[model samples]
Target: MSNRMRIGALLGASMAFAFSMAAHAAAPAGGLGATHYNLSSLKSDGHYDRFIVTWRPGSAERANPSLMRQSMGAALSRAGLVRATLSAQGMMQAPVQASYGRRLAIGADVLRTSRKLDRNEAAALMAQIASDPAVLHVAPDVLRHAVRDIAAPASLRPSAFKPSDTEFRQYQWDLKAPSGRATAFGDRNYGGAHVNAAWDLADGKGIVIAVLDTGITTHVDVNTKLAGAGYDFITDAFLSGRKNDGRIPGGWDPGDWTTGRPWQSMCTDEFNPPQPSSWHGTHVASTVGAERTNNGIGLAGIAYRARVLPIRVLGHCGGYDSDISDAIIWAAGGHVDGVPDNTHPAQVINLSLGGYGQCTADDPMGQAIALANKRGAVVVVAAGNDNDNAKYFSPASCPGTVTVAATGITSRRAYYSNYGRTVDLAAPGGGIYAGDRSSGEQVSDGFVWQAINSGATKPVADDSNYAGYAGTSQATPHVSGTVALMQAARLARGLKPLTPAAVLDILQRTAATPKVAPDHRIGAGILDAYAAVNMAINSGGTTSQATLLGNGVALSDLSGAKGSRTVYRIDVPEGAGKLSLRTSGGSGDVTLYVNRGTPATAEDYHCRSAHAGTSESVVLDHPAAGSWFVTVVGRTGYRGVSLVGKYLASR
Candidate 1:
């Protein structure tokens, strides 16, 4: 999932993220006009032969349709381009009138030439309209593929039981690592995300996670109902790869296979190579809400019983930013023309896939994310497997997303996982690469193992059992699934649905601090599924205190004035292994101090305030075994900061 597949494919010259996960299977890097796309070569079989023209806002042409049509006619006549008005579907968006249809952006009209114009001629026509002084921009309405490369069957460990959970759980190291029965790898690894402890508190109930990917593929690991009423948003006839079908109402994966020659060179470079169907959407869907503890199926998901809503956006090659943007809006129950209303809106949306480039509040993707947030949806995105700073990728870098990075069995960053401030948390993305495959070490128990079928590859149940794939693509669901657990736990406690910021606050506040020394690269820390759900199920609208000795626990949402202070007491055993304290959430100068004295008059035995803005940590390297007070002093006003403390005792 790493190596050179980084930055899969760039969408022509447009700033788009259409790259794949395995090998690079996106539009070639740059130059769509020459090397990327040749209009004359298009088969027009599934490709549409029209262009969309959008006018700038406040343009008189939009309000006066007749004048706009006359101006367009004059431009077409001068350019000698015979054309008709039709949607990409060969029908008028609105017969005999300039209409308001947001299939494209608002105030955009589809222009069909008398005869099909190759992409080059389309570009020429766009240029002609641009000279009219009223046109905003013109585009070919290109097809997009989902962000998944070809599939090479995941390195699943050979297990003994029937292809059910009874056998699969033994290899699902992501949940019960070294504690469960030994894996085929023979190493009792103890580096999973530690989700079972949380599940005991509350298995996800009645939560909906919207998975926007290739769509769901049939598999026994998950309930078919898990695929919930989904819709395919791939509107481009050429990219749908379904002959001449338009957008449909079912969210299903239809093999996304691309050879070195992409879409007849619609967007290909010498660097792009051949890839098989990734079965990506299915892998992601099962990860978020797959059934567990029933019918003897595969491994359990982070959020069991959480309904899955599959919204198919990527197909043949990859999907467009426009399509994904619309999916976000529609998933949150926002309306999209020609597409029916979503009967069941999702509370949380997971995007295991990503494209090239970053998104800002003003960009199309950023705006869509903002809209989703307004509708009370939590958007979790992968921090791309590029190994670069995450701020350079779309959605991952976009605001409001709980950006996730990949971690290995050792709870360290995956070699290829992107990092930096954009990352919000880390999860098991599996990094067995530590072992030399040339040696006897099978990469078992290293990759995120789940149920994914490669029907586009071979015949039979060839690649469908249980498999593993590594990358932030695998880590994202861990966070998304855990989110479902938190939401369920919150509602069960009779609390209102959490806002996006509050959810992020809880996640970071309850996260397991990094095993290594503190660092800003992987965001707050590794996701502690047990910690998050435990707090959710217990954190009511009250300030409750508890007795925890030699146990790592979090005190969520503590806030007050600069002169105010909140104190927590901890009892360290004589031989406690370690002791630590940390603060997170809002932007405020907070100092964490530890002292074995009175709560109000305690002396500082340890103090930490590395960098401001909520996250503060203090460690007492081998402290005195006695009663101690953990105090948070607000150097500035505290607006909902969370404090966590841990005391590990060596048995």
Candidate 2:
């Protein structure tokens, strides 16, 4: 065998907002900008005429059908969009019209305009509609695509490893423990999630994981027998590819190719190239829990015994937040009118999809997540492939979600993985580069191998197709699968499942320290599956919130030796105005590191200060609230240091 081998090509990870749009001409800056709309995710020429509106709880629009129609009509009239109907050519006609589309599970309604509007036009229209007193929130119904990878053509080689799965030896590098020993394949990656060690503790039995993406396809390595009877949530007739409006019965991928006609005219541009249907949902599902894992055929799954529930939310170009939000609630067993209730509620929900925007508890996505969390489902989301801060992405930024960033084989943050204060942890997302270093030819060890369809435009049933993919889309499943294992391990002991908060805490607490520093703060560290599973098995059944440091309180007379580190945590509630942490009157050179959700470290922190003495300060304006961990590292030995935390409540 050759010392260096190329396994497969890079698959484009489908983004909630197509990263390709960044290369296009500047999109129109709508008047007065937007309060709820995420214009940054739209393409220069992208068009949309639909808006999702959530009515105030006690508003007449939310209670009476007649009043709701009147309210919508008044808003359209004020916006000068009297042309509510479209011409035969699908063009906007005079006498602006607006109509109700569908009701969302989050108590929001989808509103369609006369025709598609560009960025500026959509913003103006949405703003006008939002001005209505009954409308609590209104934003364009932007499409969201799979956070999947682009496919590269290649062949697999033989290898020697344990487990009956044929691909486990050579291709499945992500499942094994990190190693430093050199071999013909080169130095082993120090970043593997260590899933193999977790297998001894649990295989995710009696747990259900729901994957929200492009939908599932036929693959021999994947067993859907234990899966829930899934549903398709795309509502547009053209986008659904079903030619019928409203959601359907099964979650099947009938190809989401955008190569021809109006789709290309409206959704695609020079930067956004036309492409084939990516078997994104299938790949994600396989990673979570492949049915025939150790049976000696293809690859292995993280939680092989966990039931996977496939819920289709992406189709054609992408999907709408309106549809995706509803799917989120339904996947967690929440009620959605018109659709039958989910019989197999997922213990964990994997969202390998995201869009550009910050989310809040009031937004459709946020509301849905709150419901999911209430139902005891841990929502795991990809940090995004844009290489930007995860805070700029939806769902990932949404509170209560376990936001995950990607890491390469070396445990370094994947070059394309989003980084910021919001990330929860890191997992194997594939680097495409053999080593962490950039500027080199790609190698096979950089990709995460899994089951996928070979068909470019459509499904090729029963074909044992597999490929190497890279993206936060791939990294997210690793965590979701591990969550299944942890949950199952607890259940096997005749104990109640761990709460979402407890699961996150255990995963963060047990994560392995990164072998090397990533360019940014990806999270607490690379996930340690074995440690996490073990901790889950041993933890008490009850879960509680972490302790909060007192506001304006000071810890006096603290001291540490050289290179020693001390950590303190503070709880910052949502809507905080300012957060300040400072060390003064101490005779030592120390560095300060702070991050939300997990303990702060030199390798992973959102804010840091190193200014010669103990009189250093770190201040954040409108910081995101959660558990903010502050670390004081002794650069040189000293004593009599005092640390104080001051917070300004939002007025």
Candidate 3:
């Protein structure tokens, strides 16, 4: 069975935690203005209650509107109910006094109050309502309470660094060295120039990336590096607080490891041994920000300077929507009650875990992600480990999120990675031959790296160390790290901080287009850390103009289908600036649009003509520093539009 179906079967019948009566017991002295109940038992507790009464479907008791109105009014008056209103679905939500025990039966259903019913009582009431012939499913009219968590000051590190011998081997010398140029190197050859370029900028400083997976262990790399103790939404304990040494705020707990065992559902025949510990979160963490050059160690991270804020949301049978939602909100820097404040909110959230499901705009998880973006956090999610495009998984499919697909070392999409238009970019997530795995592939060829839980004792195989595995999970961090590099470069240049949109722009614009034919699998192209950083640094804060044709033109001369449209290039300098188009001579309406590529769509930059007169101009503002194409088109059915474009200087 699918994970969702399994989880639904297991938890669908389970009740959400009840509010502590000691905490929420006190009703205002004046009483709750009007108590809404889904049950009939609560009416006797001196609290006014209201229940929904629906009409039976296809029940013909004479189709008289007057009769229906009179019947409802009589029932309300007899039940001592007040404020009765007819609903669009022919249902009524009326406030009735508890003393009136008269239960008026409509067809086979009765309307009553349930103010005395608690959480359990309400559930039973719903069950009863479901059984009623006149009712479909009765929803609790209880006041929906918002669960709040504490908010901390912004002092938490947004990124983290990994430490190990393998990492040291990867960064021992200048990453640019060609093969024999370096001495302390492993046979596993890799070009370091790109890695170094990435490190110089992002190292994840200032950007908050939340790891929504298994809780991180007290591994050496994590503890010494960017160890920002995150919350454990599952156990309701601060992970750092569980630390035995007390040096780190949260301590380690074995129960935190919730992988393996039968599915969370109660299926008796579905027995399967626990999968071996992957230490998935730790490995993912190292890739993004493993510490660099820490003497002798394991593989190096993509962004050595970045920090990590571990937010553990997945555990036993994956995680629940409620918990994941809370984690997303808190990780994005929103307040949650009970949990300590997230002092350092994440600027980027990395979600490597996803079940099989297609993406929808209205999905609850999608809504939560939208909230995260609104709070200024860029969410990056794996496309999925399954190699399919028809199914786009959650969190990744959510709007405003940067969905990442996986590419192999050769710049080809990985065989196991999902792909589609929803995918924003591709990154090098190591494949089979890239590292060592249990598949018996040669040491030099199989996936090999600093494996987490490599030396564990408890589960015996759960030790934290390095090992190489291949999946889109590994590829996501590469992009996350690049984003950090872009952000860091922007910060160094004294440029204003980037919004999520700006970051997306930089990533897409600077990406290296695939040398092979472009495919839907690889969106823009492979991630180019060096190019991205260069763009951010060299992008000056002004606008410059480009000439498409020689600086002379006549309206009638451009009349034919062969009439050439000049390609004016406008360069936006560093910082924010505006670009405008104007012409010395033109007849009909003129329109101007800006695009990054040929055949720009509505997503590109555009502005209407200022007027029909000569020297008329239209301006586009806040253009980022980059190469853009401005096209002038005749709008008034006129043969041609003549124009001169210039970059308006910014103050």
TM-scores for the candidates: 0.67, 0.79, 0.56
**Candidate 3's residue-wise lDDT over 276-394, tens digit each?**
33345666776666534344444566556666777655543344444566677878888665567687787777777664333343334555677787887777877765555513345
Better of 1 and 3 by lDDT: 1
Candidate 1 local lDDT, 91-192, one digit each (tens) = 643212122223443335555444545433454554566667776555444343333321223234333325565544565667653243455566455457
The clash count of every prediction, one per candidate, is 12, 21, 67
**In model 2, which runs have C-alpha deviations exceeding 4 angstroms?**
1-44, 83-95, 155-166, 182-184, 226-228, 260-266, 541-651
- Candidate 3 to truth, TM: 0.56
Residue by residue across 587-628, what tens digits does model 2's lDDT show? 966778788887765445788876556898999999887888
RMSD, one per candidate, in order = 13.1, 7.7, 16.7
lDDT, candidate 3, at 423: 79
Lowest lDDT 10-residue stretch of candidate 1:
1-10
CA-lDDT, candidates in order: 0.63, 0.76, 0.47
* Predicted model with the maximum TM-score: 2
Better of 2 and 3 by lDDT: 2
Among all candidates shown, the one with the greatest lDDT: 2
**Rank order by TM-score, top first?**
2, 1, 3
